[model samples]
Target: MTNAEANSGKKAVIFNVQRYSTEDGPGVRTTVFFKGCPLSCLWCSNPESQQAKPQMMYFSKTCVQCYACVKACPNGANKIKDDGSVWVDRSVCTNCGVCVKVCLADARSMSGKKMTVDEVFDIIQKDSLYYINSGGGVTLGGGECTTEPEFVGELLDRCYDRAIHTCIDTCGYTPWSVLEKILPKVELVLFDIKHMDTEKHKELTGVGNELILENAVKIKQMGTRMIIRLPLIPGYNDDENNIKVMGWFMESWGMDRIDILPYHRLGENKYDALGMNYSLGDLPNLAKDSISRAVKILGSYGLEVHVM
Candidate 1:
């Protein structure tokens, strides 16, 4: 298809465009967080990213009980309670963004926006100098980058056409056909391996690990540069046995590098904002020893290990 045709009628709902992120890829890079995900991971940090469409976010701390949203909402979704605190009836809220646009305290906010390929590229091109100098480029990530294959494919194609390095941060829950479409344009793959066991993986992520596991091998076969990432949720996938099995799987697949991402309560507040329960409630950050031990286990298999 022609570039113009590819750009036409193609748009994705993106929740964030994080610039100068050091951890997403190499050097200074922009991480485009696509909205919507198939898997509902127990410890999702960006809870707002779960939906495919735009959503509302309320910061109660900044609300002054002025009932501005109450008056602005067409659905009467916003309400002022007895204690003079503002309460948002998310059930009735349509996320019209009317309340968000009028709120001056930066409390009421919308999470995602629709953007065409060219529109998104306009923002990406702003950092062309940094990307060129620092060997950094664009990275498409969660809720799952592969969720919108065409949009992501076109975006990555554009980046590659500009001689910019590209990456995809994926949960590996999507079909291999989707990954096949994305891998050719992606220079690096930051693939998340949530769990090794099927039932346990299903329990934590609402999906079995079969497809994810299958795709990991396919990714390796495709000869894509991939770094396996483990979320390291304590009392879940962080057990020594799971780590050993993961290490064995990587070794069996000749996957040499792994990054251990320790779990944190960072998403707890986001759950509150979205009015959702945090599955890993009150779970402390993965202890340093756990991190070190995980590294040692993977390293023992002659694999390069990192605590990212």
Candidate 2:
């Protein structure tokens, strides 16, 4: 079933509604982060978003030893250890939010929430003055905004009706039809290019670049403004050869601009909270020199490059 069909109730699963964002798009904007993603990027910052369902997150430091969660859990997922600290068995936990509901110390929480299109717009509308003043509106990001194409489409349509500028921050790993449905309402598309080499792209992001590349061309042909974003991961896609290949793609495809995002450990603690192992443990952030080198290459291709 399509994302919208699965959510026929007209509600989409989202994790966050961040406001006053300057990086996502043109002006002061609100970014709605959806849950679920098809790719398993090794350096995923938002590890909690990879799952399409609501997930429980634990903060051990906040536990007050009230044992409320242990008493509230129906699945016996919460256990009191000999040290008086509770351990959560994620496998047994159904993510029913029972523990979160009973947690007095706010230690346990759920990541995703279901909200209707109008409900999301209500929050966006509060920032309407900011959007109009800054030329920024709302940006639908992921887990892959296209995963909920119908919901996002409806949200974008409403924004357009209100004259709010729209943007979608995507990985371009979705079906073209899904994108086609939303593009009419989207003013800008923040498309990601993980790797130009097909096999390398698959190895890093768990998918080939053929479909993504094809969609990039299709998006351009659809008359949508697009920006190519590259997540600069050290010792991965930041190599000279890979950067050269990426530059060539921009030049050949006539992409107007590119955004190079330096990889960082900003999301490392998130994996711990989600009870997942971080693939790139303690990896250093991409150096300024490397970013400059990449900028030079893309500049040689006559493409506008911005480090985000």
Candidate 3:
């Protein structure tokens, strides 16, 4: 039986399958972003990915005030307030996606969809020529792919069988047993490290970094190719103390490559559409000088620094 045939019963709630992406991994890649997460980071760009189930997102600016959604919603979830703003009643909303269908401006959408391994695999295989010529393949990312270990493992196993390079973009906040099963098939791991300090880590991201830090050590020992991705947030992890500690940790773990992702406000609008509050209100992007300083500090530990 094929990999998909063996895992036919398994399905994962995925938010997006971004195609022709070069930044996610080596060469060109198709990033499969799954829904569900353990960590609620203060600066998460993809707020829609945090939830396990499907969510209705409304882009207020693009809405044409067609009122089609108001008439279509059986639960009266979509309403227009007296101020001419769209209001979504989460308490009454079943997330049945009725309102999303009637959105004339293409402003409303459901964030997640359930897909079987075969369904997603068909899409991945369609880009085989791109993966072959460009030395890239598939990237399984989150909310946290490990949250749905069985489905992700089976999918990655399929990639391994086909000799297509596979990578995982993860936060590393998962049980070792999960990675133990999936890492063997993954050619590269884009491990995200938010903060080195455990207390500060918890304060910023909802969970402590003990497990994440430990997993980094284990992943290195497993002889799997991995890169440390640090999303450098201004006035947060860019402090000298944090940078120094991260460098020390990198050296201790024998991890040399580090990708510096300067913070941006790209996802701010998503929070509004999702009717969720963004914790970091109006935080500006990381300055060029701060990025340079971080690069210098990490480079002090002899890391192969790549600014993304």
Candidate 4:
């Protein structure tokens, strides 16, 4: 069932509720992936979560092109443009969700569902036993958890009241006020740092890094336990200079640990499922030695580094 149906009496937008996650935080956890994000990172792992609304996605590979969706759409909203590329006129479509229901090959799909605070709490509460055993509880990940600050803040407050260990896996791209609202309830913050260079960061992620960096420092200052996660993308931010800059920043912030997420092509397939281009497909995964080099650089600054 859609999140909306599941939370008919409440209000929030959740795209996916993933359980038994070990990598997100301190222990085994449940990750609630909120539905919207502000940045357009080229290597984003979850492109479907980018848009805030419930929208259709087409997997061309799985599509038989039988025109099932074309036939089912009542508003003539689905059509093949003059260039022979299938397109959905989002403005005309009511999101009645007719096309997705009739797709036999599972090519057409929808993302995002409206949910309520209580409905979300129910899901997180189910895993309370697991949390108690593993020292883990709930982690709010996104599309940028801060995108819907009020919902996140309320949910976080509830989790905190329940004594649940909460971690916010964020891009640090949100306003400080929003961070301030949620920081008190968060036990740990998994903040992502993509690149040190503002221009390079903008080119890669389609947003400036100034606010993100500022927010990171603010989060640290707030005394919330923080871990910086660096996605070591090859030819993007894997150079010695970038690593050194990152090390210097971590050292200055008095932050001890950082996660070196060696870049992988694992999410390339997801892009196809969403009918989006995988620009980094041709780029090979970051080499083990390259990751080691990065780790050593950070270690030189007396910072603990985990290569994940």
Of the candidates shown, which would achieve the greatest lDDT relative to the real structure?
A: 3
Query: Cα deviation in Å at residue 91, candidate 1?
Result: 1.8
Residue lDDT tens for model 3, 67-168: 899999999888898977788888898889998888878989999999988888888888888999999999999799889999998898788777779999
Per-residue CA lDDT of model 1 for 1-308, tens digit only, reads 54633675698999889888889988899899999999998888888888899988888888877777788899998877788888778888888899998888888778899988888877888898999899899999979978999898888878877888899999999987778878988899999999999999999989999999999999999999999999898888888999999999999999999988889777677777666778778687788888888999889988999888
Cα-based TM-score, every candidate: 0.96, 0.94, 0.97, 0.90
Name the 10 consecutive residues with the lowest summed lDDT in model 2: 1-10
Error of 4 at 103 (Å): 1.6
RMSD to truth, every model:
1.6, 3.3, 1.2, 4.1
Models sorted by lDDT, best on top: 3, 2, 1, 4
lDDT of 4 by residue, 1-308 (tens): 33322333436678888999999998889899988888888888888778787767766667777788898999998888675556667668876779999999897777778887777888998989899999998999988888887777778767877788999999989888788988888899999999999999999999889999898888888899999999988999999999999999989988889998888776677777555778887888778889989989999999999988
Candidate 3 accuracy as TM-score = 0.97
So what's the TM-score on candidate 1?
0.96
Q: Over the full model, what C-alpha lDDT does candidate 1 score relative to the true structure?
A: 0.87
Task: Tell me the lDDT of model 2 at 289.
Answer: 90
Error of 3 at 217 (Å): 0.3
The predicted structure with the larger TM-score, 3 or 4, is 3
How high is the lDDT of residue 132 in model 1?
89
